[model samples]
Every structure is written in structure tokens, then in C-alpha cells.
Target chain A: MPAGKFTQDELDQIYAFAVDLGRKAGDLLMERVEQRIDGSDAPQTFEEKENAVDIVTQTDEDVEVFIRDAIHTKYPTHKFLGEESYAKGESREYLLDAQPTWCIDPLDGTVNYTHLFPMYCVSIGFVVDNLPVIGVIYAPFQNQLFSACNGRGAWLNEKRRLPLIRNPIPPMPANAPSQCIFSCEWGKDRRDIPDGNMHRKIESFVNMAAEIGGREGKGGMVHGIRSLGSATLDLAYTAMGSFDIWWEGGCWEWDVAAGIAILLEAGGLITSANPPDDFDTASIPDVKLGSRLYLAIRPAGPSATESGRESQERTVREVWRRVRQLSYSRPGA
Target chain B: MPAGKFTQDELDQIYAFAVDLGRKAGDLLMERVEQRIDGSDAPQTFEEKENAVDIVTQTDEDVEVFIRDAIHTKYPTHKFLGEESYAKGESREYLLDAQPTWCIDPLDGTVNYTHLFPMYCVSIGFVVDNLPVIGVIYAPFQNQLFSACNGRGAWLNEKRRLPLIRNPIPPMPANAPSQCIFSCEWGKDRRDIPDGNMHRKIESFVNMAAEIGGREGKGGMVHGIRSLGSATLDLAYTAMGSFDIWWEGGCWEWDVAAGIAILLEAGGLITSANPPDDFDTASIPDVKLGSRLYLAIRPAGPSATESGRESQERTVREVWRRVRQLSYSRPGA
Candidate 1:
């Protein structure tokens, strides 16, 4: 397939548009929160998506519609894929192709938003030829904005270049888990089926958090375990090098498409969250937006003995060895 | 024993001094982080506290000394209890007494600070009559300041009143766990002994996170579980009503003293993290500053049939029924 092409001017225009739209959407989110806090807005009403814990509020729907309308008005020819629209069955088929497409998660941490937890964001990504190339994410609660494109390095609020460590990014630790601050999610999948996603996720969390020598050598004894309840923020934090690793499963392309672009631009690595059947001969697998599983590591400093990529790969492989094999797929796939 | 008495003017002066000191300490923390990020500061050096996962840095000790010196110069007669002093054996005996005492954790979330994860803060707490009477917590990274004194309501940044809900705080849900956002910690303890702190903590996390109606009804199915790696911030957020419930074990008095003061002033409730042997007859136990285990809930709005305290207690009792009884004591206690 031919790669979708865009001139330098066009790419710059798209990036600017995404950033402007993200900030505007973030403003709308802030307005809603403030209104609710002051009792100006009525109590929020929500509907369950997959179960009781997986929810969708009217603001999510409103924000998606707002973004879609603005995008359609500005770039009438561009195709768009958004979480709320997809959930509503407006897009019945997978939309990726060798074309320019906009993927968006209007409110990435809806649960956090509903609970006023201050970690939610507005994520917007531009994809080209099935690759995430241009990304913009705005977390209004923190007033943080992350943006990146294919070749240009990522930035925080359009000023500070990421991995945020202007110094040489430190190399991954020799014993990865013992020295790594890892982030993961207990996603919507809550089933207890043996070896299923939830069961595997719980087992993986315990293994990573257990003593270094206990649990029959499966203990990761990581520096810390954090669950921010938002994959977008988790990936963004990883891109900025605050979190050294992020492993996630059972989320949609819109949930991570933008974060993946920023992370890669920050010189990070992305691979399948699941390990290979045999590590002796297999290289780490690449992660696609639709894979529904991913493992991300921050940019590593190059050492005399190993290149940055080599160190990252070694760390990924070590982590893979300690975690359970996880499986997840899109609904009805 | 007589209660330590303070004139209203004295209390007001103390509160102002604490807030000023906290901000100054926070500024120092921010300066250090920026220096390290810009490669202008020397690489951080740390000493392991309990094990590899628990660490202390020069900044923690430096900040503590700075605060202690300032307190001594201004209030020479007042006693002081701080994390670094106790760790260094400066004050050998337990100092909680009916005296005007200042308890401080110079840099809470030291691990996150070292990693530049941006959840750290300076915590200054004042105790009188063996009670946390005035509290000030400053998170410079986010520029959030939480302060409170007895009688006067809590404030965020000295402007917004907390729970931050001016109208009325929402009542606890009837089925508590299913609607609560819980904050917990995977602390320095990593022992996997049967029913040990680590063992019980992991089990409780899994139980609360599992699907409802799973594992023979032990599944709590809470809305979300967040581990911020900072008990001080956890308690502060709880005081602000951002987190509905925070259950913590194996933390220090300096870690929670200030936060406890703010939480109580915000109309929240604090109790033991452990459940009693007989729920039918036992009342929820009160949590002391050095209890090492605590369960806190947000301020509940009164309902037709139940007052705010009753609602909070009911919710606490329900959560207690779902979690395992955890035991933790200070090392060599």
C-alpha cells in the first residue's frame, strides 16, 4: 500500500489545528467541572458501557460531537474516528486504511472526570497510512499539553521537549523491575476466567509487586506500582520519562493512538504486552493501535556496552518474563 | 493530664508560620527538580530505608533540617517531631504529649520526587493535646496548598474551601465499595508470609478490584484503585474530597499528622483500617496519628434518615467487611 503523503505546510496546519481543538475541548471540560462544583450545573447522569464500573457520561458524548462538528467544518474531506461514535455503533467497520484519518478520545479518563480525580484529558491523533504520526493531548485539570508529529520530537505545553530529561536519558537499570516505576491498568475486563485478561492482570500486578525472590522467582519487586486510571495519561507520563514503563490491555485504538505517537517521538519503544511463546529466537513484537495490548518503555541512555534500543529491549524482555501472558480483543472481533 | 492551651492569636500565628514554611520548602523542592532535569545538579544520591523499594535522599534530610531550624528559631520553646530527626536518633523518646509540638515530613513521596513523578510535597503539622490541630501541605509541582486549623474550615491554596464542595458534599452510596474511589499503597514491606502486611495488602487490593459477585462475594468491585506512592498527598486529596476513601497501613506519624488535621477539619472521618471481631456490637475505632493503619472517607452529606457521621461510619463498616485484617507495627517497636 502507498503511504499517505502530506506536505510540510499541511502537516504543520494539522498539528496546529489539533492543538487548538484539544485546548478548546479542555476548556469545555473545565467549565463543566467548575459548574458542577459550584452547583450551577445539575447533577451528572451516566450510563453503563460494559458494566457498572465502565461508564459513559453525557459530557463525553457532547464533547465528541463538539470535536466532530468542528473538524468536519474545518477539514470536510478528512475521515474521523472517535470513541463515543464508535461506542454508539455509528462506525460499524474498522476504518484504518492508507489515508489520513483523525482518531480522538474526547475524554480519556471519564471515570476520573466523574469522580473529579484531576487526571483526565482530551486526546487527538492524526494517522497517516495506518501509522500514528501527529498527536495532541491536553489535560486541563493540570493545564498540561503534550504534542508531537512524525519526525519532530515531542513537547510539553509546546515548550519543554520530552522525555523532559534534557540530560542524557538514563539507561534502563540492570535489574529492570527492581529499579522501575511501572504503571498498569485494571481495565473494564473484570472476568475471573482462568488465564483470562482480568485473571492475568491481577496475577501480573501481584507478581510485579511481590518480593524480589518470592513467588517462586516471579516477583518483580518494582520501585513502585501506580494506577492512574487513564491509559492516555499513563502513556504520556511514560513519554515524559516520569514512569519508566506502562503495560496496558483491553483498550481501544482511540485510547492510545495519540499517546503512542508522543511516546515514539520521545524516543521510547512500544511492543506487545504479551510475551512470545519462545524468547530465544523471537524478537519483540510491534504494537498496532488496534492490538488492545501494549508495553511501553521510556527512552534509555546509550551506554558503552549497549545501545539505547538494546537496553530497552533487554528491560522489556526481563519484564515480559516476570508477567503473565495476557490476551484481549475488541468486542465482536 | 491537662490539655495544651493556646490563645486564638497564638493559633493564628502558628498557622501562618506553617503555611509560609511549607511554601518555602516546596520552592526548594521545585528548584532541585528543575536543576536535576536541566543537568545542572549533581546526580541524586540515596540510601535505602527498609529495602530496595524504600529510599531516602539528601534532599529529604536537608529539607527536614531546614524546617527544624526555622521552627526552633521562631518558637524555641515548642517541641518538634520530624521524620528525619527520628530516623537520625536526634530525639530518642516518643514525643507525643500535651505540648505545642510541630510534626513534619519534610519531603513526602521521596521516591516519586527522586523519579520526578511530581506527587511529592512538604508536610507541616502542629499538634496540641496529642492532637493534630493545624495542618499545612504544599505540593509545589502542582502549586496546590492545603491548609486547615481547628474550627476554621479547610482551604485549597487559601482560596477555595474544601471539600471544595460549597453546596453540600454527596452522601456515601448505600453499596459503598461499588461506588468508591479507593487509594492504597504497596509500601516498603514486601514480605510474602501468610497473612503478613504485604500478603494481606495484595489480597485486599485484589479483593477490592475483582469483579462483583466473584471469589465467593469477597469482590469489592470498587470504581478505581489509585496508588500515588505518597500517603501525605493521598490524605490531602481525601481532605479535598477528590478521593472517596483512603485505606493505608505501615506509614508514619509525620506522614499523616498534617493530613489528619486537614481531613477532620474538612468534615471527613478517620478510623482503623482493620475491622473488629464483632461488627454487630463493635464501634468503628478512632485512628491516632501513630496508629500506622487508617481508613478515611470523604465528608458525607446528611440524608433524611442518617446524619453525615452515620453515613460515613456505615460506608466504613461496609468496606471493612470486604477487606482482610492487616497488621503492621513500627520496626523494633
Candidate 2:
């Protein structure tokens, strides 16, 4: 009944089970896609939520129900939190409280799925005492499986270390704007401009891309921005170093839990996308899903010299400052 | 000795031959990429032109030379225009003047290729009397070959009729802002905000993405924007219907020649990104490579009803009207 009480064998078993379940679910996704290649697969079964721009389909729900049932039947005591079950307040209760909590997004990047885009995936994670202990993300389209267990290291296809590229790389110039490859997405919350905040969100999005220091340019002008439409792949790719950093907000805990475990297990750093000035990225453990933000940094290459990590830190710090106001800071923060 | 003199069979023969050359060159590109997988390929052999953001690699030069030699040896009477030969004003002489002209991009999306991003490709176009008679764009990563000969319809992998998704699709809702998926890229020209035509370019970019209809939202708040980092893939994907629309300017003629042929052959329509009043989407013949701007639309579905094409044309017209001032016209035009 204590935090971190599970033995190493127990952790490994859970990881193996999750990987199997995730992969099976991923296969199910692929099968449905293959069956519907004609643009006529259960077209009526798709529904829009929050906004027509956001969508969910029968496949998403079917896969979630299947995974939930399998994991619950196998480990009934484990608290399960999934995207489909978000209305049940599953996202808010992150405390593991001596029992394991399984966090999952049966199908992340639902919009991309509807558009037949290639980056959607199945993300599964196991948490204990509010800490993600096991993670597995399966991108079925590309047949890529990214996984990691706490303290056991990370691997792709059960081989090779995390951060596809080795360390000792050069830093982005200054905030390393044009040299940095950043990935972010426009979530279902599009009313931010007219109904909610005073154009902070859209303005921020534009600024990050505007001329570095021009009148309307408050953004970092990074090398590029990818709206890959899949948070799970975004994080999985970041964990793999396919992407340098991923900044996001307004997504649920399950959307990032699995990928976060893989990221941190591989020695990557994460925090609120809009952390405070005193925020120490090294203290990633303090960050919580409730923050409604996820800013993940790739690990320095394995071969990077000691100074390599230092340079990356400086760059990350500068980026943090530039994006400090990204979040809707609660009126008078 | 007249314009448009080539027969359908001649056009087809040229098409078949260019596909072969493009694929061969794509294979050579892959070989070079594999050899430099470790960020070590011709590391210093890259030279910048115009600016540091615009670069030329050894592989680019090598591929251009190889294609030029092969084509010249076989068709000594043809006038060949290539990116590598741009310094000699090869791009300026667009007039066909009886002799056939081969316009080729040895390497398109050089930035993505150098970054190993996997979206770059080789684009080859053949023109007879100023008409794009044959086109081939080969993307080696996905092994997808897109080709179009003037009258012979466009094909992907020589099979599927393009604009990947069949359409008779609904138009974007009035507030349909985020329902439309659009793509635009940030090219090497960063000074477009300063030294250029008074920030018209950046302002237009900001407008398209601005909060839909907000006082600041002068643009279509489309579903999302993707900067895939490659023009060839951008056009290739546009041809495949992976993207609904693509808007670009300032890129070389060779950059679009092949994709343009494929787009037209596929029945897709293209016009300047910002056309004059009374510019007809149906009159695509008036648009030329020298225009320096392109706005391409996805075509109706292959099996679309007669009304389907009309609906598509309507949508294109609306989009064009909304984007009338996209480019900075010289003074008052």
C-alpha cells in the first residue's frame, strides 16, 4: 500500500501486457482503415463533438471499450482512465493512492483518422501514485511501436535507445528559433477567439510564427511548425527525437500519459507548456496532468558531451521565457 | 515547327521516359541519403545561394548533371532548363519556340532532404512550344510516382486517378473557418517582412490564419495549416487530394512544372495565388510559370455526378474571392 511498492517483475509484466493490448487495438484500427479504404467505411458512424471540427468515430469507441474491458477484467482493482470515459471525471483524479491507474487514449488524433492522415495512434499508460510507470504507443499506419518502462530505459521495436539522434548537437541560434523543429496542434477549442479569451490563443499562435522581432512578431520563428494532428504521435516522435519539442494545452491526461512515460523514461524533460519563471525543468516530476499543458524536450544524444546537455538547457530556458504567457493565466496570475 | 505539335503518342513516350529518369534519380537520392544517415553526408559540401536558408547540396548538383547529360544525349534538339542552370537564365526563357524544352528540378525540397525529413523529391517536366506536355514527380520515400501526359489523364503508381479522395464535398460553412484544411510553407525568404513589398506576404499569411472573421481575422480560419517543408510533396499531395488546397509563391518554375502537369492532367485547376478581378478558375491556360504564385484546387471525385464538378468550381471561386489581395501587387497594378 505504498508508492513504488511494485517489484520490478510486476512492472515488466504490466508493461508487456499493455504493449500487447495496445498493439492488438492498433491492429484493429488498421483493419477498420483497410476495410474502409474506399472512403465509405461506416461514414454514418462518425460524430462531431464540441465542434464539427472535432470528431469521433465508432472505431474509437469500440477500441476504447475493448481495451477498458480487457484491462479491467485482468486487473479489476486498477483505476482506469480513458478518453472515451472523460465525462466521468477520470482525468481529474490522477492520484494513484496505492492502486495502479491505467490511462489510455484508444485513438488519439481522431481528426487525422477521419481525414485518413497517417499519424494517428493508440496510446496506453500505467500509473502508480500518480506517476506514469509504464507506457506504450503504437502507430499502426507506419507499424511503429514506441514503448518504455520506468527505470528500464526506452526502445523502439524492442531495440535501440531513445532520441534517434545522438547528442552534442548545436543549439538553435539565440532561442534557436529557425534551428528548432517545434510541433503543436489546434485542439477542438476554437471558440477561444470570439467567446473566451481576448484573442490570446490565436495571437500567440501567429506570434510564434511571425517575424522574430517585427511589430507583430513575438514568436520564436522556429525552423518549422508541424500540426501533425496527433498528440500521441507528437509525443511518441518527440520521445524518439523525430521531433525536438512538443508544446500543447487543452488536451486530457490520457492523451499524453503514455507518451510522457516513454519520454521521461528515456531521460527527456517535460513540464507545463507555460511554466513559471522559477520552473526547473529538472523537477519534471512536480508537473501534473491537471496543468492542462505538456511541454516535452528531447534528450541530448547518447554521445553528446557533458556540455551538450548544458547548451540544450539554455535553449529550452529561453524558449520557456518566450512562451511564458501561452496559457490563459487565470485573469490576474 | 508549330506550338503544341507533339502527338499523343509522342507525349506518352516522353512521359514513360521521364518517369524512368525521375525514378532512377530518386534511387540515387536514396543512396546518398542512406550513406549520410548519420548527419555526415557531404556535411560541408552544401553551399548557400541568395541566403543561408537557400542551399544547394552536392547530391543536387550530381543528380542535375546526370539527368541533363542523359536527356541531352538522347534528345540533342531539346532545350533543357534546370535549377542548376538557373544562373544562366534557364528559368527566364519560358517560350517553347518550336523546340522541346525540358525543365527539371534535380532536387526539390532541398531543406527537408538535408534535414532527412523524407518529403523531398525529384520533379521533371517536358514542354513543347511553351506547353507542359509531360510531367513526372517521384517521391522515393513512399515510392509514390505521380505522372500526367497532356491528354492521357493523371495516375498515381500508374493506377489510381488522383486527388486521393473522391469529392462532391460540401463547401466550408460561413463560420466554416476551421472546417477547411489548408497548407502554406515558410520558405527561406525570411526578409519578406522587411526588404520586400511592405510585409504583404506575412500579413497575408497572418490573415489566412487569423481568428476567423475577427476584426483581425481577414483570412479563412481553415481547419489547420501544414508546413510540410517540401514544395514537390506539397504539390504531389495536393495532386493526391491529401490536402484540399496549396498556396505558394517565390519558388522556381522547375519547382512546380512537373506537379503542375500532374495537377492539370488529373483535372485539377490552378491559377495565381492572387489573381486579378474577373480571373476565371476555368481559364487556367492564362496562368504561367512566370507568375511566381500558385493556388491549386483539388478536383471533383472520379465518379462524381455532373453537378459535382460545378460544386467544386463554386468552392474554388469563393476561396479565390476571399484571397484576392494575397500578394502585394506592384503599386496599383
Candidate 3:
């Protein structure tokens, strides 16, 4: 299938369909949450896979199946890729060259779900030619629904625009103390890595982000650091400008697919963990497939005389450069 | 100024006064927030004491003074130790001599305040002989107010008892995956500590926390980690059972004072980061004033077949031991 540019009418149809699907998925999860709370129904339990905490509940499987079935029924020609089904050899490579494919994580934060924390959400994205064209993420518990279509703007609950604050209080002056927030998973492969490389990487990043001015005036002391557990929520919140910047590693594509689209639609910037301009479509597919890291920054005001967009891009690149220069060693290495 | 217990009537009066004070403080904050959001007012500007991110806004000082004045007007003889005024020599040590005292962090998360992140709160605690006898914490933006009196239980919005699960889930099993969530701050004294130590400590903790079962056995994965940016909210969430555990270093007593009271009243446990214990007045006052590490855990079911208070205490101790054994470094040390 060709990478067709969506007409206004096509965009409208897609928006309605995406919203309906998002709400449907959200309603199902909410029902399950209430049932879990009431103790009237037990979530279908599954064998402990990677770890007990990593158990795949029947709800995850059922939810993915429900989404996939509904999408197939509505748009029989569209391809689908979902987290749970992907684990069963359902395929990871997207047909970017085909009609828009749906990439979904039926439940973006299963651990939070099992533990009953209210940070989990349902994330869905539409990709065409390996680029996110439409995205919808819903957190039923918080009653937050964020969606965006390519070239159009993003919205939260269909009213508020992305970057909840239209004009953020101006950016802190250069050399002013800044704060950086990072979202990361402890990850399922903790024991396999040597020298604790992942841990070292995070610590190094935090240290750099939180560094105060030194004797030679080097480090810019950051105000604070936060890790709120859910990448989808973190990304969305970052897009909303609640956080100045977000750096994340070891997350899957489904983890951020919808969030990336939303973030971009909100005038946010995301780059490969490596560096700016190193970002491209090939990298985009892997980013969605969960093989890469991301740095997302809410748009910032221009540097005195610079344009706002240029200033933001430069700031993001500078932050990324600082991150990459730091070397990390895995545990036991 | 004696170490005498309050009569039920006195307790009732104190509780009523605290609730009123909390609501009034919350109202002031909400008003400011609304003004800032509506563009009617500008972000509070102040001198940078430690760094630009470490702002000393006028609102913080004004709020602290208001709380102190209200308390003084009602209880003229009571001592007050507040974050903003303690530098004038009104320290926690004075409160430890068996006198009635109030501990207040007028704005617990000032950075969140500057960013309008909606997680900041007003933390207040009334102590007798340096023991937190009554506690109140209010997050105006979220409209969440948590309060507790020693031996009287805890409440959210004066209606919900903590660990707010309508259906109580059983305590995580011993063999349950070691999924612990931790909270830490990028404190002001980063330069005093070696970057290597910071890297090693964080690496060790995250590594241990992330490790799924290894040679240690099954169900030993560290479930996940979170750093929500506020000590008060972290403790409150822990008491609510939304978070399994919280550990922090470098925060003053004002940061954890009210939270400590609420957590204890809700059947949770608090101990020095160095060791587990039944925290009491002697330890709390000094700890509140000085920078020390703390760990708080929600109520968990006793180990299988463990009966009696002694057994429960043992189980709690074992859990604490297991948790502390997972390493996190002290920055300077």
C-alpha cells in the first residue's frame, strides 16, 4: 500500500475511530480495575514468565485480543502489532510501506496494574511508512485521554492542547540551575548484565543532570530528579510541560509510540539517545520496537535573540551531548 | 510545657484547630495557583540562595509566617520550629526537651511550586517532647489533605482511612518478587560527594533492585523504582499502600515530620536508613532537625503462621533487614 497523505475527511475519520477505540479499551480496563477492587472477580492468572512480578495477566492477553479483533473487523486490511501478541511470534517488523499499521500496548504499565498503582494506561499508535501518523493514549483511572493526528495538534480530553500551559513561564536563564527528570525501568534483564552498566548509566546521567557549579564553573546544579515509573505517563506529562526534560532508556516502542506522536504534536522534540540529527525513520521503527532510548524536551523559549524553535533544538542537543559523553560500565565487567 | 497526655477534649480541640489551619493554608496556595494559571500574577521571584532552582520565593516565607502566627495566636506558649524561620535559631533541639512544639515545612516541594507541577504541599506537625503527636499535610492543587493524631488513626480528606484500598490485598509474600519502589533527591550538596561514589551507590541499588531471580532463587526480582520528587507525598503514598516502600537521604525533619506521624498512625513503619527500629520521640526530634536517611514501609501481612505482636515485629524487622541489605550509597561518605 502507498503512503497516502490523509485528506481532511480522512483525518477526521481516523480521529473518530482512534478516539472510539481508545475509549473502548479504557472502559474495558476500568471495568477490570473495578472488579479487581471489588474482589468480585479475579484477574485471570498466568504462569510466572520472566519473574513473578512479570506475570502476564489474562486481562493483558484479553485486552490485546479485543483491540486486535476490533481493529481487524473495522479495517480488515490494516496490520496490527501488539505487545502480548508480539511475544508469541506475532511479528515485530511493521509494514511501514503498507496502509497505516496499528502499534499498541494494550496495557503500558502491567506492573503498576498488578500492584494497583494508578499510573498505568492503554497506548495506541498508527504508523505509516514507519512514522507515527496518529496516536492515542488513555489513562482511565486518571480520566486522561491524549490524542493527535499527523500535521494536526494534540489534545488532552479533546479540549486542552498538548503542553497544558500555552505559554510556560519563560525558560530558566542559561547557567541558571536546571532540573532534569528521567523515567527508566529496572528492566527484566537485571541479572544478566555485568558491572551494572545500566545502573551506572542512570547514576551517571543523574549526576550530570544534578551537578551544581564547580570550582571552575562547570556543572549546572539541577533542582531535582524524579522517576515516576510509567514511561507513557512520563512522556505525556513531559509533553504537558510538567517536567523540563525526560531521559529514558531500555523501554520498548509500544512503551512510547503513542507518546512520541503526542509529544511531537505538542511541539516537543525527541531524539535518539545517541545525539540530535542521528534520528531518522529506520531508527523510528526500532524506537517503536523498543530497541532504543529517547530524550524528549518540552518546547522552550528562544535564547535571547534566537527563534524559539531553534533555541529548543539547540538546548535538546546540548543536553544529549552531555549524556553521551558519560561512559558506563556494566556490573561485573 | 510538660510531657503530659492531652485529655480527649483537648485532643478534639487540637484536631479541630489543625484542620482549620490546614484548610486556610491550602486556600492561600490555591488562590496563588489560580492567579498564576490565569495570567493575573507572575511566577514568584526570589533570590537564589543555593542555586537558581533552589529559589526562596516570597510566598514560601509569607505562608510560613502565617502558619506560625496562627499557631502562636492560638497557643501562645507553644514553641515553633519552621523551615523558613529555623535559621533564626528556632531549631528542633529546643522541641526535644519535652515541650509542646510545632514543626512546619510551609512549602515542602518548592521546586514543584516554581514549575507549577501540582505536587507541592504544606506539611505541619505538632509534637510533644519531640514526638509528632498530630500531623497534617495538604496538597492544594490535588485537593488531597492527609492528617493523623497519635493513636487515633489517619485520614485522607477526613473521610478515608489510609491504605485506602476498599478491598484489602494481602501483604506481599516473602517469596513475592522483591519489587520495591524507592524515592531519593538530588540534594544541594552534590559537589561535596565524589561522582564515583554516586555512580557506584546508585548502580548497586538499581542493580540489586532490578535483578530478577538469580542464584538467590525464584521471585527475587526488584519489581520497579520511582522517585516522585516530594518526600511528604512519597510517605503519604506509602501509607496509602500505593507504594511498597520509600527511602530517602538528606532531607530535614520538616520534610518528613508530618509524613512520619501519618505513616506510623496508619500501621506503617519508619526507621533510620541505617537500621530498623520502632521510631520514637528521642530519635525523631534529632533526626527531624539533622540530615539523616529514613525508610518507611506500609503495613504488610505477617509471615505465614507468624502470630502475636512479637512475631509481627520480627517479620517487620526481617523485611527491613532485607530491604536495607540492598545497597544505596551516602553521597559524601
RMSD, one per candidate, in order:
2.2, 4.8, 5.7
Q: Between the candidate structures 1 and 2, which one is better when assessed by DockQ?
A: 1
Query: Cα lDDT of all candidates, in order?
Result: 0.85, 0.68, 0.66
The prediction achieving the highest TM-score against the true structure is 1
B1-333, model 3: which lDDT tens digit per residue?
222667656866887798789889888887886676556786456667545555667778889999999999999998888888864453334334467778888887887776666678999888776567788999886678889887677888898777655354345445433654444554444552454434433533553365554424322355666666688888887776677666666566778878887877787767655443542212322233333567666656444565323332443343343433323333221
Q: Over the stretch A171-246, how does candidate 1's per-residue lDDT look in tens digits? A: 8877787778989988877765667788788778878888888878888888889888899999998998889889
lDDT (Cα, tens digit) per residue for candidate 2, span A1-333 = 222888888888888899899899999998887565556654324676765556778888999999999998999878987787764342344333446889889998776666555568999988887678789998786677889998788877677566544433333244454455677776555552443432444444444554566434445655556667778878887776656667777776788889889988876777777646665454433457545677777665422333545555655565565563454322111
Better of 1 and 3 by TM-score: 1
Name the regions of candidate 1 deviating beyond 4 angstroms: A1-3, A90-93, A331-333, B1-3, B90-94, B331-333
**Deviation from native of the Cα of residue A236 in model 3, angstroms:** 0.7
Per-model DockQ: 0.69, 0.30, 0.41
Tens digits of per-residue lDDT, candidate 2, B5-85, equal 777777677778898999999999988865554555443246777655577888899999999998989889889888877
